[model samples]
Target: MDSEESRCFSGYDGNRFKLVILASQRAHELSSGAATMVDRQGDKNTVVALREIASNQLDLSTVFGLAVQRCRKYLEEFAGSRGIAGHSSHVSPSRSSRHTGLGKSFVDNKSTYSASFLDQDKFLSGGKDDGIKGF
Candidate 1:
């Protein structure tokens, strides 16, 4: 390995395995159109990732956190597409429609509920109903 590559371990607190994993993940990001943190200098994505790590330019926490968020969003969409309800068992069903004065069974009305599920921001914000109905 190049001296820079060897130095990459320091970025992960001397954890060689973590350095490798994080570098590969960063390389994947580069290939997926993420901007490089270090100058490209005609180097491959893997090399750029290693250099960024070696120079301590990469934010490791953000890398791991973004991956987690992407996985969570994917799982939520997958569950919703499969007609699965809320992923958490602790949140009572009544909470989903509490502001609308609709009973828990309101979610069972697919015609009305589907729109809310698709626009999760509005549904989750707990705003008052607009007093309107779909035609």
Candidate 2:
């Protein structure tokens, strides 16, 4: 049984740390009310633990996969809550967010960008009198 145990312990492709963690978890579960898959006539918990490890009952990759799924769910929930907590506007912002010298009505009723609505007199006279910065 020692050779078989060594073979099982060494056959694991992943890190030994992960394997020990998973095996210890499985042993705890087995010692609890969890059902055992292999035959258990007069087996001790150590034998059962080794057999469980050898039989591929507890896979580190599968455990990591489940943990990843749970982490993703938790992160998504956190992000969603943050979005709701910090969210303010369902409608669009005002046209003058920055200090741009333009008003809501500077563009015509059609859109914010109107090709024919040029302030040509202000530009040609070169005076500081656009009167949009007063607001």
Candidate 3:
């Protein structure tokens, strides 16, 4: 697979199959066979983890807890923005009376071109051949 696809697969946090595909792609790009072997091991670990999560062998809370722990680690490593944990209680404005803009102004419509056909013809011709020369 392409590098973009591999990156996307690596970024996937949802499924184990996706992770395996991504890891495989990365493994394939390795110059040394040793790196490929290491990737295979990682892929196997991901598969095992996925199976444990899927077969009810692992508790849902435990899975979520692990995910949260990993997310915390990532957050600490990246020092990125944290997510909100509580529900919002703020009142929303009524949809019908919602303010759109400050005010409306009546714009006067005007035509820049002259209405006379002769003026239009002259303007269009650039004062060159005025159709007098027969083809």
Candidate 4:
């Protein structure tokens, strides 16, 4: 029977794919009837440790992929819960200010626009060769 410490040590490998496989195997063995109850309990501990190792091994890209997947799944459920169709969250052209001239305030520069909008507005302002036009 593997000690709890040994199971934990087995998960310290730098490769996450191997850790996930190890965890899955442990989980299966723990849930199976082949081991004594005490050994099974130890396997369960190993399984948990392996899962933690797998999660820790995930790089930023992998984490981001998982986050995006989760967001897509839950966003549909969230929309449905709010009495809206999941697919109805489309980006409507009418809802965008680009075509509506709602961005005019920032472009005209009569009032100071927030810094976040300054860069895009500057591009829309045409070349610096043109003098500042008042609203």
- Could you list the CA RMSD of all candidates, in the order they appear? 14.1, 24.1, 26.5, 17.7
Q: After superposition, how far is residue 24 of candidate 3 from its true place, in Å?
A: 15
* Error at 58, model 4, angstroms: 3.2
Q: Write the per-residue lDDT of candidate 4 for residues 1-135, one digit (tens) a residue.
A: 247545656745343433343454444443554332232343455555354444454233333334334445554565446444323244355654455554343333423233232233332334452223332
TM-score of 2: 0.38
lDDT against the true structure, each candidate: 0.59, 0.49, 0.33, 0.41
Model 3 misses residue 64 by how many Å?
Answer: 1.1
Question: On residues 11-84, what C-alpha lDDT tens digit does candidate 2 reach at each position?
Answer: 55544444454556566667776687677657776577668767866654554444335444654575455442
RMSD of 2: 24.1
Write the candidate numbers in order of decreasing TM-score.
1, 2, 3, 4
Task: Quote the lDDT for 52 in model 4.
Answer: 44
What candidate 1 gets wrong by more than 4 Å, as runs, is 1-4, 7-13, 70-135
- Candidate 3 stretches with Cα past 4 Å from truth are 1-43, 80-135
Query: TM-scores of the models, in the given order?
Result: 0.44, 0.38, 0.27, 0.24
Order of quality (lDDT): 1, 2, 4, 3
Q: Which pairs clash in the backbone of model 2?
A: none
- RMSD of model 3, in Å? 26.5
Global Cα lDDT for candidate 1: 0.59
